[model samples]
Target chain A: MSAPRPVYDPSWDRANPNEVRRSIRERGYTGYTAGLAPGFVQANICILPKDWAEDFLLFCQRNPKPCPLLTRSDVGDPSLPALSDNIDIRTDVPRYQIFRNGEFTEEVTDIRSHWRDDLVTFAFGCSFSFEEALQDDGIPLRFLANNNVAGVYVSTMPTEAAGPFEAPLIVTMRSFTPQNAIRAIQITSRFPNVHGAPVHIGDPAQIGVDLAKRYQNVGDPTVGEGEIPVFWACGLTPQFAVMKAKPPFCITHAPSSMLVTDLRNSSLAVM
Target chain B: MSAPRPVYDPSWDRANPNEVRRSIRERGYTGYTAGLAPGFVQANICILPKDWAEDFLLFCQRNPKPCPLLTRSDVGDPSLPALSDNIDIRTDVPRYQIFRNGEFTEEVTDIRSHWRDDLVTFAFGCSFSFEEALQDDGIPLRFLANNNVAGVYVSTMPTEAAGPFEAPLIVTMRSFTPQNAIRAIQITSRFPNVHGAPVHIGDPAQIGVDLAKRYQNVGDPTVGEGEIPVFWACGLTPQFAVMKAKPPFCITHAPSSMLVTDLRNSSLAVM
Candidate 1:
């Protein structure tokens, strides 16, 4: 009836980026891609009609912390050769969210039937790369250990507006003990493409964030005693901007469903 | 009459390290060395009998964050060739503190009268190097702007003991706005030869520090609102260890009256 919900194969966790993409394309392994292809970069995806693409590009360029552009597909093309060879944007992503007039309309495993010649695909750097770097440096991430996501908040800080694209800055909050928090800042500062260093630390109220009040309750909304809450510009800010713009038609990879690339996470590190 | 208190030469602010040493050695510029020879290294000086030198060396090795040993001179040698070709330990430092049997006995401009064949001189890295790095990175330091020193605290954390050389870890605390604090951490991490990364952040009591109760009222103890206090291991920790060890006779650079060296601060950055 419902095109059987995408199933996850545990073996996919150890698969290489190409094999993982092949599974999503040919074997129907169309589930959330977190923890798959461990060392590769996973990008946030946004597809919009060519007319709205220019403004979005300016939006990303102006607010790079929240929307670091990894690569963009040529208008009307389904392949992003810069991200990976043999990549078919229409089907390589595990799941897609369809929007009409900026209202999320439906969820689909593959976007082939919805593809149009006027569409452009934008790939953005995701925090997963830096998170991996932090973990590799031996800094423990509590959310990852608890199987929870970082808390999300809508901060009073506003993003620079570009044409129809404008929204309040969105941030993802993570709590760390003081020493690890300092280490996290140093480690993340190395990967500027993947959100870089935190935008704020200590009192969330300074940034107009109430720890108890999270945006959409998307994560573990708790800040334990003795832990410092650190906030970073989130990729979701662009999604919020797109929602506000209400473009006639748009598409994005569903949450946790990223576009995997051949690029190594270390390759994005400036140092 | 006591030797005339050294006078400040504003021009020395731009003088080379060797010139600064010459002024200290022959021209009587024996005062606090802060803000002199801006781009060069200023070391904390310690001289002890050879019997006490080995234990102090082990103490520095075990507590590197607090006592980063830059170079040590051969016993009976008055010159530290590694720090500067012209460095005479007895006269290069602006002022020296003499400790006799575990107590401060007096302060002097020249330690030549106090020098001995059995005496060994140890030069340690100081925070001035990393502070310069932070300021160069455009992070404003409030204490420096106010013409005040960083707050000093004796924490509950203890140093790894080396014979009789052990004391509570001492830290220098600097407060900054959250964003600047993060930048400070990133910049300081590049210079591990100095104090390197911060040892603590956030609540001071967690490390047994009561901001109001500073060590000897050494600095401005205020932690302003909207600011985060970042603490780094301090060179004073070794002085504290020396006091506890109660070496029969010891010599050290007077507070803020450091030994100016030919080494550039940039040479200390690992990155």
Candidate 2:
């Protein structure tokens, strides 16, 4: 209750993605898109050259839990008609991370100047949909309350592979009272496109996670009393595989800044 | 796998509850009803005098988590037309425990000799329906595989009161690998009548049950490695309440013995 209240606009006002993108496009706004477009789905963007697209698609297919693909663009297509009519992959996201030869290069506000033909845009569902779902159900997630990312941990469970795109699954952990934990499972399970259910719960060590200390490179958890740690496949999983597979050129959403989609959060539910 | 398999007609020879009930009534079958009614719903039986029925109904209405009432029969009616056309209150159940002033009196194959014109029957959903739902979803409940009843524990949670029916919640525990436990939560959640999802999960001590100790009067839990214990509201709640209240007369199915019904468990799913 003491946290800064998220600002919401009832009409297609300042909070709308289209309007937010216009602000970002003009360099008027360049910040994390966490609370913007609150009820709509925000996607993790991964743009790769056409040659590496097929391999990544194969990887996603093999590891749906970690890389739940929402939509894929045709080759050289900067516009993602399937995701939103007005979506321009080059400029829609608040910020973009440019990677070259599998290494972190630089972060940019817009990618239109770096855009090219033979580029394939991917929009993978993120944890935001399920996080919103959990909050709506009155299940308190600790990180959101703390205004920090949920605890991220590397697990021993290996992801299914498509050629070189193989890595241990990366997961986000959240501890909850057993009752709320059950409700969290039931709620998140309905949205499989957004990592769905959970990959593991209870003892972190069972999944090869070091509970006393996190991976340190990523998030660490604080497991509380009467609560159990629940894990969900993380979107970072694709980044790990993509880095290992190292296509000549790749683009992804800047950490915590995602591409807002026209699709409603409720629309992602498989049930 | 080494556990004794409960009687089941694999080809669905025991598809209908009526057929199964007929077999039981004719002495063609006298085993437990655990696997007999396969897809159909099975219920917990509670027969009380007309004077006690109203309070009991209110108790059930107040404590739906434990006593999810499926149907109630008219005074002294042997047939619960809603559950099955030929269901006889006196002989359908394989065995019955008759209670006098809430004291354990004796067990009988049939209660015809004890039947009273003033007696009314209350049928409540049993966990068998949701357990079958869980198994259908490929979630293995180890207790079932071990050929034992679920681990029953008395919880600190209290049911809402109606007249003299007030007691601590009784829950049946099922342990699952963290992954399957989440799946179990999703599958059973859709069927609120069968106790609905779980009342508690993770550490048992939170619910007032000391993990190292077995319940005061129930079976031992067989929790194994990398598994989390999940607890569901048990039908035994009402029986405990009745015993505490010391009703003038009562009759219930012998533990592990249930009354088979014509309704499929799927039909009770709210979603």
Candidate 3:
């Protein structure tokens, strides 16, 4: 059998988010969506059983920067007409990670066979929108230059709980010169729905992340001298909480793989 | 004599700028206005013969940050009805520095005897307003704690010439931690009338001031390690240019002595 094409290849970069979602639903494309959907908002996907949905919704309400909700589907509805007319929450994302009894199981290209009538879907604002805003402001982003998002991982800080939904906060770190960091703050501040201005601006230890060990288990933590590390509440923050509040059934887009929406990122700017 | 009261003390702190000006005009108080009228805007006063006024005005236009004009009196007029109701520029400021043929003469408490019908008055914004803004933003100002304004000096950069009025730029430097310096930039950026933002940030030598010697020829320079020395256009900049032009006569506020206005510092915020 022939091996499948890689997601980072040029062809995928040019593909629109809706088109990518269509292919995932039809062709079983299980790959990352980091550089996809150029100027559109990409979401952190979460599908929960009705039993756990209300609490997670409340958890997002209490901590908006990490989980700004773009749209949420009605229980067992499988569709979000507001985000995209044709979006199917059940199988539109490129890949899904199944969590059974609060633990990770095998990743799958399609989740149709596992769908339940009580599953409710939530789409959240992600950093890609504001990352686009930063570049347009003439501020250089080192990680994006190498085609990467800022580092991400769980922090020891716990999140506000709603009933059964509770977990530690997860964050993403971006490093920039003092001047550029300020510009980044102003630019990102305009996009509050996408994790507005940095939560912390200086030393990493204050936020409980080892600069030398960043998402250390998941990503790079080495920051250069004179460069300040800015931490933003991350989309993965909700996932970490979800993992802690593991219900009988939960699903998420595979890490770095998201559901691209038809909405443009500029539409997210508060100003 | 009660050993002659010191030139400046916070005891003068609560005094209103207009009250101070009225007292100085009457020769009742003849000292510096530093730290008086805490939240009010202070102005650097300049008086020039009508012949030289046009060029000096143009010079101010060319270098606005250094010579931001708050108000200008018509030729031969000392009353600035626009800036304040009971204002008489000739006798308002606590002290005045007399310049004859571009050379410093005696400092006087009142200029009424020296004032002439052919002279015009120029009021420029000083750093006191923006400094107040930084403090309000929760950015600690170290120099204020040490009872000093930012350092003063002349730079090699030449000012645009209008008539005979022309000279190199003069600036003020204040050191701040890189992070605080960035906060200072954003806060000050709102007030263009008060030397908005900074001309240059980081290494001082790049702008031609030898950090080691500074401009002690005019005033002392204070900078600390791990602190970026941010420079702003100084109100004295126009004074330097005006002196070089050397009409028959000119006058300016004495160093550290300023004319207080009824206008609050908050009145200058553009945002």
Candidate 4:
């Protein structure tokens, strides 16, 4: 007998986090998880062989603002029960990017073939979690409207190195009126696990960022009249460190494809 | 017979807040209250006749960022028990500025001779309180080092008008490295009774400020290399509002001559 075909359900957008993960695990949903399971935590997933896990963990600890480590799975364990009840690291994320010695190898729907007894999974809080917080506080995020809410820049600021991991800090910029910028700082400050407060504000040039020059243009780059740019530590920072570390084997969620978990975003607030 | 002369002891600087008030009240100490009662709350005093009290109260409510009213004495009452024990508003402050119909009339060592049955005392939290908090957190105030830690500027931003009270907001500028500036905002935000967070940061021109031309210069005007100017709503703002309001009679503490209270500065932290 042939296996039944997986059906994509539009209602999944409004479904619970568990349902969203179920669809992704079953191969029914393979798209970016940006707005899915709103209010729940979406994580940036990074997997490495057991030999390189300790150094990567130390890297995150040393450079917490950019790589806020939320939880890590037991060595050789594929489950992150601390984050959710039914997480299977090999199949939960919608898409995975495979890297071999710092070079992009391929993308895959699931990592069952890559799962092994010598692997460790590390999950870090993503900036997407704090965007919900900023929005809830009435701070407007431009990328929400124009589909490009931020301009990515590699700051001259160097990350504190741990073991072999070292890289320039990557920041994502969002412009707001000075008034709203203060509110943004206050709101994001409550969620340190998700980047926590701005790393720097005002004078992008001080951080070696040229507003007109963006490393990746995923959002509108315009700083509106009377609006000042506020920059936050981006989750891409660890991926950069990983690239420079050149681990023998690594797995991460494809850019924009995150691990949607049952944990609520508000639960991440330190306050 | 002549009254006994009060002893002058240099150790009064380390004395308790109430002792400092006693020294000032007894004429043993009649100098600026800065660096005295180091950890206590120092207040900005505004005494108005009962007829003008209501309007001034409304003015404070309308412009809380600049006029964070901490306590108010009942009409005809000279005591501010809310701020300390044995508190007599007429004698606690070191010096008084008598204003008649919005014009400066005279300065006095004590207000007992000027105290009246119709007088109402309003004590607002002073920036001196938050300066302590900032210093405790290791954010340096330049004015503290050179005895010119701040520059007072009259900004183009207008206060919310209440009754006859309305004037351009008065801001105090303090320069810091961009990093320490963010820390200053976070630390000051904890004491809303004080000015709270800064009203404006960066680009003094945006707020109609010319650093070289301060309304009153108490500190260096230089914005050093790699340093940005941060402006906080000054206690002087309410004094400016009172000046414009033009009440029939009002009394305020002389510049830098403040009321030292028993309340600890740390007690004012909201978080």
Index of the highest-TM-score prediction: 1
2 versus 3: better DockQ goes to: 2
Off by over 4 Å in 2: A1-12, A215-217, B1-16, B28-30, B211-217
Each candidate's interface RMSD, rounded to one decimal? 0.7, 0.8, 5.1, 1.2
Better of 1 and 3 by DockQ: 1
Proportion of native contacts kept per candidate: 0.86, 0.89, 0.00, 0.20
Question: Which runs in model 1 stand beyond 4 Å of their true positions?
Answer: A1-13, B1-14
Over 4 Å off in model 3, which ranges? A1-37, A50-62, A68-86, A152-178, A200-211, A216-233, A245-248, B1-39, B47-86, B100-103, B116-121, B134-186, B198-249
Which residue pairs of candidate 2 clash? none
Interface RMSD of 3: 5.1
B92-194, model 2: which lDDT tens digit per residue? 8878898889998988878899999999999999888998888888887776766777888888988998898898999888888888888888888998998
Chain A, model 3: TM: 0.91
Q: Output the better candidate (1/2) by DockQ.
A: 1
| Best of the two (1, 2) by lDDT | 1
Q: For candidate 1, what is the interface RMSD?
A: 0.7
Q: Which 10-residue window of candidate 1 chain B scores lowest in summed lDDT?
A: B1-10
Name the candidate, 2 or 4, with the larger lDDT value. Answer: 4
Model 2, docking class = medium
Task: Give per-residue CA lDDT, model 3, range B25-129, as digits (tens).
Answer: 664676656667788888888888888778778888887878899998999988887678888887787778888898988787788899889999998888889
Query: In lDDT terms, how accurate is model 1?
Result: 0.89
- Candidate 1 residues A1-271, lDDT tens each? 1333446566654459998898889878767778888989999999999999999999999999999899989999999998898799999998899999989899998999999999999999899999999889888778888867899999998889999999888999988888889988988898889899999999999999998999988887777778888999999999999999999999999888888899999999999
Candidate 3, A115-213: lDDT as tens digits: 989999999998889988888887777777775567876666667778876766788888776557656766777788898866666655655777566
lDDT for each residue of candidate 4 in B1-271, tens digit (9 for 90 to 100):
1222335577655458877887777745767777778888888999999988898899899889899999999999999999986888888877788999999998887888888999999999988888888888888887688865588898998888888888899888888887788788888888899989988887888889888887855456778788878888888888988888788899998877788888889899999
Docking quality (DockQ) for each candidate:
0.84, 0.78, 0.16, 0.52
Q: Is the docking of candidate 4 incorrect, acceptable, medium or high quality?
A: medium
